[model samples]
Target: MTAGRTLFVTWYDSNHRSIIPVGRLVHHGGAEGDLFEFRYIQGALEAMERGFQPFIAFPDLCKVYRSSSLFPFFANRVMPTTRPDYLAYLEVLGLDPTEADSVDILARSGGRRETDRIEVVPAPVKDETGGYTTRFLLRGVRYIPGAEDRIARLRFGERLFWMLDAQNESNPSAVALRSADKCLLGYIPDYLVTDIAKLLEHHVSMNVFAEKVNLPPAPLHHRVLCRLEARWPDGFLPFQGEQFQPVGPLTAPPTHADHALQ
Candidate 1:
């Protein structure tokens, strides 16, 4: 991974353990109870405890503000690009999107009571090679539990987002946090996906897993095609793997992964 890519952090209130993002998954969700919030607080506290100052996203949002009480140790500044995606998932949870501001934090900081709210955070924006896509550090990283200090020192991140490619979706965990036993959790906004093309490729990978989600085809940049062609003895072709088996007689277009490490 190159330096200064964007990371998106989102939390879902479910009982599944954190899924590791490797191979094809673009995002990860499926945390349970107050786990998302608690882990976020842990992420923040861990940062401050390490003697580094912390920058905060979602400052206008209550859960983020309340998170401050947990660290009374570090100061936080608002990061303009940090957008959280909890509002969308809250509806799926069958709960009203509660604001951390609506409740009194003095009573809830350590209480860890159900606040009926979810938190979302996005990495600062960057390009495929981890170059800054936006001004400032708005897209540097998503939330990394227990990694504030380490991330602070590194430009890109040693952290990886662990989500199953939707193309490779799997059965939900055996545990039950929802009323019914559910399977196929799709969105948990973790990891820093800087390459839109790579993200599109990951979506393509997800095609093998879930058919319900809408992932569209991506137009490859000419440079990417040239790079792919340069790599092959005959010419560039789609990567063939167990899940991403190609169908057409024609060659496959280059994906984000093809040009990622370049």
Candidate 2:
């Protein structure tokens, strides 16, 4: 990933039982200095109509927030290097502290906590190979009966397949991950459900496997890591739907504004 990367910020509306891509936090690197900015998107507007309130730190949805470093709200989510087990923390996420930046770490670990319903996801970038790859630590593990036991048997690099659960009341597009023996583990992250389904529908060549598995003592979200890669279909852009579009600029002139990222 480049220094100039954007991470999508999502808020879960528990009442609506939906996840909204409300804003984007962008990092821009330049010869002079690095800059970071956060701005609400059109989805925020819709979310507000659905009873969502702007976060206290970002009270005005229209005002663009610029900072020389990651905002405290997000920066706090990253593990501090001072911690003795900081490297071990990254290890559980299958990341090297030397290689993963705050943005990279947040993207993979999701920056999710019991405190709030916020999540940060890295946008999938196309590679020179005309393909793209991304990893998502599986969610809803505890909810699935026997999932914890099944995950214990998951071997690194073991193949996994997507199984659709159309009858699911919460999300009809819900897809579950399973082993060859059909040990139902968990569902895909809500954010990637639609995009993954589209990929499967087109019959794209995909490689899905167990990237890592950390047992108890690890948070539920970090329990299972999955790596998925697929050949890039022509003109494919993940999360390009209307909801993901920005209503405000990703990086403005350090002033109030409403413009989209280039």
Candidate 3:
């Protein structure tokens, strides 16, 4: 039963502290273009909330984590506070040299706690169908200056990665965030591309609740995702099939729906 779980690992630092509390960040995106990784972790947390045991791995800094014991909640199981080398930790897990993906890692422990640590969770979303009964709380809003195309699609397992910027006119100032259920998704990527239409049929963009309460604006990185999705071509698709699927509502309001206009 423990054969098919996924363990999501993320690395963080001072920048993450600016967006949200270091503790709540376990489920939120951290600095270093790791939002995609956090998306995987969010799936795990949702699993835990649904009575499933989920395992998440994060670095335990002496300055941050007070307890020598990493395991906090029954749902949130922490790995041993070893050093942060990827290959070395793989060895510590006693895994084979050929194992590259965390999906291959078996749950080492027995019982419930063991199973929770390895299973993969799906992203919480309300598809166009509006079928599922669950409603996940909206966390932080992120603005990616360059990821419009990519974030707009919001498909099954898509991930966004970037750094934090506090000086934007939208968010007043960089403040330490503490809410456990929500976080504003933000990241600064190393690369940006503009001409996404060369590779894809449709443009991508998101309608986020702006400071004006109900107004949803196309986020900053909407351009970035569009460009990356366009240039990379085959790299973005997890499966080799039809692409350009809309991840959110089919018809957004006129003002918020147009990323290409802005």
Candidate 4:
């Protein structure tokens, strides 16, 4: 795994189509294993007003706390210990099941509706050119007929807009993809939500467009392809496109066998 990966706490209000960044978790690598430091962000002021306190046991909001273990706020994302447990967790996120790591789960659930209002999302990982690309199958085609014809007419790289679909009955975090005329194209995949949501929340410049559109006789969800490229502005701090390092090596808590020995 890469190093320097940062995780953030974000609050998504589906009613207002808003994402508020509340806090950040940075991994300080060392031999103590999985150590992390937590701090709140300015965007979290609203949450603070609403009585949501920091996860660490601290009285000062400006103070930073480090733990050689996972904090309770983030431990929920890493608690599943079995396949069934993992699947159940994924179901809560409205994601299809597969073998996935904590990072994958975090990325997918960052945009999850059924989970808590605040979620943990990994910061965008940029490529060598200080940019990153995201590819996803378009969602919500069933709601719009004639989408096939409309998609067929779209040219590659045609600009698209990502907006929060506040009125979506199915998922609150449903991000709608729109054309220049504001026609609904589809949605960003569940997995891509965390990164894209954070980018939008922070007012980052992103170039989004239709990458590919499959012909009919195929599933509607898979018919339209979309992509988002980060156009990092000069001196954009969040655009830290660097290798991610793990906080520390993780060791499973003692199991029944270990208890028996003890």
Tens digits of per-residue lDDT for model 3 on 1-262? 0111222221212222221111112121113211111112232332334443322343322111111122233123323334365454444333464743322222221111322223221212233553211111122334333223323434422333322345744433322121122333433221111112222233333222211111124223221211012123333322112111221233322221121210
Q: Which candidate is the best by TM-score?
A: 2
Name the regions of candidate 1 deviating beyond 4 angstroms. 1-114, 127-262
User: Evaluated with lDDT, which candidate comes out highest?
Assistant: 2
Ten-residue region with minimum lDDT total, candidate 4: 253-262
Better of 1 and 2 by TM-score: 2
TM-score of each: 0.18, 0.90, 0.19, 0.52
Better of 1 and 3 by TM-score: 3
C-alpha RMSD of each candidate structure in angstroms: 22.9, 3.6, 21.7, 9.8
Cα deviation in Å at residue 35, candidate 4? 1.9
lDDT of 4 at 85: 61
Across 49-127, the per-residue lDDT of candidate 1 in tens digits comes to: 4342222333321121212122221111111123374343222222244543211121111111244222232233324
The segments of candidate 2 whose C-alpha lies over 4 angstroms from its true place after superposition are 1-3, 248-262
Better of 3 and 4 by TM-score: 4
Task: Give the candidate order by descending TM-score.
Answer: 2, 4, 3, 1
Clashes of each: 22, 0, 34, 8
Which of 1 and 4 is ahead in TM-score?
4
Report the C-alpha lDDT of model 4 over 56-118, residue by residue, as the tens digit: 443455655566555655656563646666665554433456665454566544533354676
C-alpha RMSD of candidate 1: 22.9
- Indicate the residue-level lDDT of 117 in model 3: 24
